[model samples]
Target chain A: MRYVLGLDGGGSKLLCVIADETGRMIGSSLAGPTNSSYNTPEEIELSITSVISEILANHNIARQDVSIVYGALPADGQLSISTITKNLHDGVKVNLCGEYVLSLFGAIQEDYGAVVQAGTGSFAHIRTPKTEITVGGWGPILGDEGSGYYIGKNALMACVRMADELGIFTILQERILTYCKQVKMRDLCTLIYATPSNKQSTLIASLCPIVGKAAAEGDKVAIDILEDAAEMLFMQASSVLKLPDVEARFPLTVAGGVWKTNPLLFNCFSTKIKQLFPQIDLRYPLFEPVIGGVLLGLRDLGFPVKAKIEELKHHFSAYSISADLFQ
Target chain B: MRYVLGLDGGGSKLLCVIADETGRMIGSSLAGPTNSSYNTPEEIELSITSVISEILANHNIARQDVSIVYGALPADGQLSISTITKNLHDGVKVNLCGEYVLSLFGAIQEDYGAVVQAGTGSFAHIRTPKTEITVGGWGPILGDEGSGYYIGKNALMACVRMADELGIFTILQERILTYCKQVKMRDLCTLIYATPSNKQSTLIASLCPIVGKAAAEGDKVAIDILEDAAEMLFMQASSVLKLPDVEARFPLTVAGGVWKTNPLLFNCFSTKIKQLFPQIDLRYPLFEPVIGGVLLGLRDLGFPVKAKIEELKHHFSAYSISADLFQ
Candidate 1:
């Protein structure tokens, strides 16, 4: 019974799933960030090796027993990838894929479609039979419009505008002060600017949930912010739909914690996209990205991927209950 | 001579003008940044003392003979002001004014009007007969719409969007690459993010001129960016104008390096503003902020401030020929 391992990661954490050739779940493990772009090579290597080792040990299996290892990470901003498999078992057949491909494979399952991810950062990936392209993943500063960072930063901007008396009054002013545990909102600048540059994106993006809370509470400012963010993200999806090669009814899915955590944002985004492309098949991802990694390995072995995916998800439904997928 | 001194400064530099009680120009000195919020109190004190010392020494005037010392610094982020005059002459009355007041007095000269400063950051100040108010001076993070930093950042955003193939292509993509000495527009992220947070605003705002260049050459993306920035800032000025106490034909002036460096942005903003508030008296600044400090000193010494402002500008025009005012 050959076993395959699937690894999916970002700048913050990694999730791994190990399964048999038949796609029966064998074991799994989690580890720290392994992003090649943001994390040092040393850090990436340590995360990959330790997690693989932990899973092998946990399932009472040897590293050499694995049939294949496949991993996916964010493709944007990557400067170099070097010697990642130096410590892995020989001939284990390790392959690394871009996060967009991982997400696409997980959701569309080799079909021609588009995937939009809106986690801490945001980007859109469109996959045609012959071509694949990503858009708007310019991180926090250059792009990431309608991502967590964008929504969170807009919430802060609204509060200060209210403070400046030029903006309509928003409850976010008091909410932010309460959330930040400060008398004034200006103290937030110190808290945000003092953070290290590498972590500042996450620090700012973390405010998304608070904004989500405000919108849920029916705060107009928060609602406006969420809707504006929805519009921005929709623009990326719209841009993809406008590609000459894409079919009129091409499939598109919105993924990431941002969509799941905020009903208002999700509903707003969905309404806008559906309004523009009425005939398009808009979808929520059917399988998480880690599952996509596993399916890639299954496809390499020439197995009937659709059957194996269903079987693995059926056997692992309770196990996949972790919030790991949403984040 | 019972000389009076006026000092106006920001996070980047300090400009000082020394004059007799009648506002006859004596000597002047330029020094490093003395912003109390971003700079160390020690640095502020050092800058103030050294600049004052330089002017007194240059003109062979005794520090003890100085009658009054008035300075204006940005009021938005100031945590506190320590003793900035400990090194100066004993019994010298050192009064500090908010930058808004300095700009206000410099332009309106104690009249009821509004002053908007659009330097590296953006903010608006209104002076009524009864009270004073500042709007939208929330620094780079919270506000500063249509500021140098805002326009510069928007230009970068447009370039990356074009690279993503989702935005209209603009010459700015090539211009930014050449400006930063990079092969691709993405390299700009590295150049910008690598700078320290304290200086990042200025570095990003520095891109304002390149954006101005593109707009002058008729890049639609660049033109759109400048126009959007103009709209955002116009909202701030419009908000101030809407106040119940402000007159139908209130006096207003636009001040800052941004206004002088970019003629296209100026015209776009001016046209939009004039179209909306046709009755408004929109004037360019009559005197620079440091001279505003001089006017403040003149007003304190029972001098006719309008005459003194005119006299000082006439006599100092040869020296103000320095791009120091534009910057």
Candidate 2:
């Protein structure tokens, strides 16, 4: 009757799941922002401890009675397990991994596919039986080349250019200048630099539909921006798919909001990726990474999950969101 | 000894200037957001009072002693002097004029002409001896057809579309999606609906330059967006110039940051406007609107401001801004 606890931590919130050796659900809990990259290690530990405590309290269990605890954390730069465990206390046996790993595990149960995690940043990691290739996680300042932040940042830059007359004004330019209160191009630069972080990215990303509406209306600029995104993403993915040791018939699971939302872009991506790696197989994730974290925890405790995967998949299939949940 | 006060009440901050009969600067002040449309009269009054009081105290002048007060208010949904004057207290003669008017006055010293304003929103206004025909001052939600906010909003909407596969993915799309922290396109809909305001517009508009850079690098989408903006703005200006009662050769003074910053757009605008209104003339404001407000105030007070305009303009001419001033 060994119990395992699994947690998925995010910048805004956290989700925890508890289960027994047979992968039977015991209880679950949620908490506030627990990503170490955002919050301090102390904050992360406290949040995890509090959520774990709440789950145990709700289920009438003791922390000492737990069999094993496995969690994927927001790694700063590396995915070394000992480093992640060091961020926590000694009572728990933790498996160290990057945020993308949880997303990958959630997307596919196998160990040989690629996951493109596009959150506040962008990263693509391909895992093979013998090796893994990672590319394009340079953060918003340098790269995150095809991430939302990058897109949003670029959009703001365009607005500023339009305002300044440094560039031509498109329908997109007209809308952004009017919407952002950046009547002056210089003000656009000031307001942006004055912001605290990549919050601007969030703001820009929210206007996806407007861009679509404009593109639908035959705005060449909007369509071109979208096309460039697909090409860049494909290019990034190719860098990993074309590795010398990479398999010719590798399976790639598309994960990320961009892949899930813009089907045109997705089609573009699929076509581009297929064009580059003709032997690649693609599949969508059955469950969210949060659930994947739970499965991983149960697996670490020697619990069988293949059967549970189908059971849960069938149970939640009705509520399943077909879009990629890679954030 | 008549004195005039010019006020540029804006979103992020409020600017005030005091000039003598000849537009010679006497004093100046600054305050926080005083745009009454976005805030309460009381709040605006309080903010303005703090700045005014401080300036008067520092300059050793009395409010009542000032002969006239001219304000370029964010209001003027329809020109109502009483509505604007009602917001201020006794002792100051209020000439409730449109923000565009002051912007125009700041640019060109004429009572009749046209000015295009694109700040948090975009609008075009034509002031003739008989009537003032405003082309597109509708707020971000309604019109703002060619503004920074509009562009930013469109960019975000594009991301949402990408998230939902309603559109294709471009470099801009992927960049924006990563910025919004939304794992799915559905989440973008939620976040956008959660908060839609000028602040969000500003955030989105900030991405304009990045779009420009991409366009410069031969990103077709970015280039198309710029072209569209130029066309929209040209059309807006044409709409104002083509009014039935207006003369074909009315002067056009570009007031807002959009026309002032973007040389290519302005050149395009000039060419397009000239094509439609052969007699159209362009005027660039040499001084900030605060100076215009002060000069207007002096004139209203029957002060000999003919000489002051030059001195004040000379002083303000050296004011250099590195970036966009809008909030």
Candidate 3:
């Protein structure tokens, strides 16, 4: 029996796994961000090939034994099979898929459902047997409502606003100042502006957890910011529900760091979604998108995916559980 | 008679003028931004000295004959008299002050009023006979409501949101797409993120005028964004009014490119200000901050200011009437 491989590439990180026909995931690896939309074609190829090499070497599996490869990334035809299969077996089938499917199938067993995936960026993916659609995955400057960078950005802005008396007093100012080890607001602004563009997004998004913690402590300002973020996320979901092809009965679930970091956002999002579409079933994702990638690979390769999914789930209890594994 | 100099250094540009003791502004020049808070001390000194040399050389005046220099800048004690007067007369006097005073006196010709200065960023300054205080002006990342950057940023965000179907359709999507020559939303997001940090803020804020044009065309999204900016600006002013040192009746006027770009923002701001504080009088600024700097120099050095103010206004009618001269 040949082994099938699956790789899930995200906006900020990468994950890969290998499994035989029986559904047991034999190997897994983590790598840097590999989104073709954000990275160069050469960079994307290098990341993909390197991850393949490392996983094969670590698991002591031969590259030629892998009969098929399935990859999910935010790409737009930037990669080709001939390029990815270099130095390996000729004509090894490679399927380059969008990250949305990984998020969609990893969260639910059924084919008809929608998932709001919030990681470094955010988007809602709705899919059915016949069609699929996406909403609100614009990058930092354009949109990414309820995303990590957006939450962190608002927290920093609130600190400066309170200092200027333009906003009411909030614990974010004190928490952010102490976190950055800054005594004044101007320094914090400098830190954000001075950071090189390569690292600026992460620097901003890294503060997301702090905002979540602040909301959990009953800070009104933090709660308001989180609630607004949740409302925006709900708006994205509502936009998906408006699609003529999707009925109101489609199952909906939330995934990503923002939802798990704070219960308040999830509660707000769920409450709003129910208020608008009470018939739509809400499901907590059975698995995050990365694990969903592996399952997609198994089924696409004509393997027994259900038993393997159960076997792989039992084996990768830690790695395949969450969307934000590297964080 | 000795000549006196006034230099107003702003967040994005600098203006310098030379006037005779009798209130005649004989020479004026434009230079690059010289905010000490944002630029290095050496850069600040270079811009300052270069502007001084340009004005003096253009006017055919001897440096030694200029007895006093009145400079209003966004500085945090980054300059010294010895460093500034290195090549000039040994004992020549330099009166360095914060830019807020230039905004305060330029707009009202009186010491007791509040001026909301909107440029690349926005801030509110209130000075009564007894005390002076500032609200907002926390830079782009922190605060800057009603600022050019804020307006432009929101406009860009709206276009993408509309594309995702998360927001209602508006003329902004068409206007922005045509302006950027972009066929897709993803390319637009890349264009913004790929811009270098040095020119990024200016590039984003440049869209402020475009947003105003859209609002004038009756785009509801554009109008909503402008109204939000105006509301934030009103919040800054209200914060100033909350000060215990000043009564609520203080004159409140808006001065900046944003106020003059379109009448919509100013109308909204004025309506809200009056709705909350009817006794507070609203007046148009008599002169922009640069001309205010010249008048300040003339008066502070014990020279005639009022007659010169009228003379300068008549001769440089093109310059001093608005805060956005260099734009």
Specify the highest-DockQ model's number: 3
lDDT of 2 by residue, B1-327 (tens): 656667777777777777666555777888877665567776676666766777778888755666677776664433324433443346557776778777777766577888877655677788888788766654443346567666556555445434333345657665554667666545544455345444655666665655545555665565566666667777677777767777755778666554444444555666776676777776555656666676566666665555555565465554322223210
TM-score of chain A of each: 0.89, 0.78, 0.90
Better of 2 and 3 by DockQ: 3
How close to the true structure is residue A172 of candidate 1, measured as C-alpha lDDT? Answer: 78
Q: Each prediction's Cα lDDT score? A: 0.76, 0.62, 0.76
**Among all windows of ten consecutive residues in candidate 3 chain A, which has the lowest summed lDDT?**
A318-327
Residue A192 lDDT in model 1? Answer: 66
lDDT of 3 by residue, A198-278 (tens): 677778888888888999898988999899998888999998877776665788877776777877888888899889989
Show where candidate 3 strays beyond 4 Å. Answer: A35-46, A74-83, A87-89, A109-112, A129-131, A184-186, A322-327, B10-12, B35-46, B72-89, B128-131, B183-185, B248-251, B279-281, B322-327
- Which ten residues in a row are the worst by lDDT in model 2 chain B? B318-327
On DockQ, the stronger of 1 and 2 is 1
| Candidate 2 CAPRI category | incorrect
lDDT per residue for candidate 1 within B1-327, as digits (tens), equals 587888887788888888887668887888888765578766776777688789989999886887777788643223223343454565777777777777776665655788877889988888888777777876676678999989888888988888877788899889888887889866777777667777888988888888878887988888888888778778888878877788777888877778777777667767877899888888766666777777677777888866545566776574342333323
Error of 2 at A27 (Å): 5.0
| Candidate 1 TM-score, C-alpha based | 0.86
**DockQ for each numbered candidate:** 0.50, 0.03, 0.60
Cα lDDT tens digits, model 2, A1-327, are 667766776666677777766766777788766654457766766776677768888998766656655566663323323333443345667665666676777677665678766555666788877788676664443246556655555555555444433346658766765777777545555555455443555565554545545655777666666677767677667766766667666777756555545455566667777676788876666666666676777777766667567765654353234744323
lDDT of 1 at A209: 87
Give the alpha carbon lDDT tens digit for every residue of A100-124 in model 1. 7767777757657888889889988
Q: What stretches of model 2 exceed 4 Å from their correct place?
A: A23-27, A35-50, A57-65, A72-91, A118-247, A256-268, A299-327, B11-13, B27-63, B73-89, B118-247, B256-265, B268-279, B301-327
Q: How large a fraction of the reference contact set does each model reproduce?
A: 0.54, 0.00, 0.79
TM-score of each: 0.86, 0.62, 0.88
